[model samples]
Target: MPAFQSTFDALIQSWKLRLQDAEAHETKLPARMETCIRVCEESLLELRQWVMEHSFPCRECEIYFFKQVKPVIKARYIYYQKIHRLHTGYFNGSGLLEKERLEKELRELAQYFTDNDQFFSYYRNGYTHHDELFFVRGQYDWKICPEVNHFDDLFSTSFDGKLAELMAYELLMKYVDGMLNPSCKLTEPATVTPSRSVAVSRLQCTASVTDIVELGYALHAKGFFNDGKASIRDVMTFLSTMLQKDLHYYSRLFFQIQERKSNVTKYLDELKAGLTRYIDQLDEQDQLK
Candidate 1:
């Protein structure tokens, strides 16, 4: 196991502790939600602290051990995936503009890490066998000096470190909601009753209400809702209000929801494509720098 293995292990252990505690005592929704938030927050803090403390060695060592040898890159990749999920989750529930913004950031971050990882790969041989004659000779080779090319500067700078606790917390909440709903894994309930009128023996917008309720059930079936316990009445009421304000809202919401439930391979391909572009950009920058 590598150094990062231990760091991730520690993180997992801490999470397990939180999870255990939460499961044991958090029987209510409020308590469960709080515990889930805490679990996410504490894990994020632990990772942030670890990166700040061990950023140097991880970067330096990984250059030689390319092909995902070090923990830092793997760590970043893992966090990136988590963050992407959160972003997607949020996007699924948000307005179009918000979803677009998150998608942009997701792509940019993916590209940034990909570029950095490729940059490290360039000096892999020299860094890997530092004691070898060829490696030593390469060290003083000014033409390829990393410092002159700002490799050190670029490498030392952690772009992803800019991730904020507030942002992470929001994203994690979205993820937690998705996880608990279980709708993501199973079909939504077949029928959910809407509130019926008890007075005047009259109903209002019954067809519209029924349609909205059906849509909610469909969305829930598609694993759109974050809260599993959110009653049909709750979903129907929320949708009724929103739809009354804007009939086109569901169309937008459904698009994002579909994206959240998009094929996993789609995301994997995006990451791969971003990294490939990053390598090309790194090569261009190397020449310019």
Candidate 2:
């Protein structure tokens, strides 16, 4: 039991650190979510494999694994999966229609909690009268189990899956709420001067807004301007003015970049190759001279 607990603690700590790193990096939302989901899957698999290979010395330890440990790990997986679905499926842009869709999803998630209020209350209030039946193998009560399908009699109990869903839904609600009502102050568009307007008019962005947004994010990540103090919105606003393009939805476009399965930094890679070729031409001319 002590060894198992210690190993589980270490696994969770490692998983958390990886998640933090993924979040801290300037990756796309879907990419970060993929990393988070992978980490959770790996951790859960490790725990499941260990439990299957070993027998618990007593019922108390078995209950601890199911009621406390396994459900928490499974909850994390469920949470990330649901979040990934939302970002990939529901979210489009910050337009009225998108906001409406997100709000509707949020309400649906809330309704799930309302539907399962009894189990939620039981779990949240720390009532453990049914721990033996809920956490122990071969003690499942079909009448009370929220899930009827995909039962794993060897490793899962009737209520643990429900518990995991409850926890995951709680986290999902908070995330969806934050999406609908972000706390960050909106950045207004930069005021354009007459001279700046003329210059912007003279120069046009031939590339797609998606490409420009990719470049803007790269520059922001590299701290190319204002000693890295500039927010992404600021950089985007400047790029929009310079290119005479509306980049108000750069964040949404960036999310699209994240969803790409291959060549996520397509534009950035192209830029690098193009610059190298230009330099090579200049070097060849200098050698000829």
Per-candidate TM equals 0.28, 0.60
Candidate 1 minimal-lDDT segment of 10 residues: 157-166
lDDT of 1: 0.43
Which lDDT tens digits does candidate 2 get at residues 1-289?
7865675787778878887897899378778888888888888788878878888878878888888898888898889888787777865556232777776776677567667767777897898888888888888666777762247877788788888888887777767656754443334658999998787678756999889999999998998867777767677777887678887545546666776899999999999999999999999999999
Predicted structure with the largest lDDT when compared to the true one: 2
- Model 2, 118: alpha-carbon shift in Å? 0.9
lDDT for every model?
0.43, 0.78
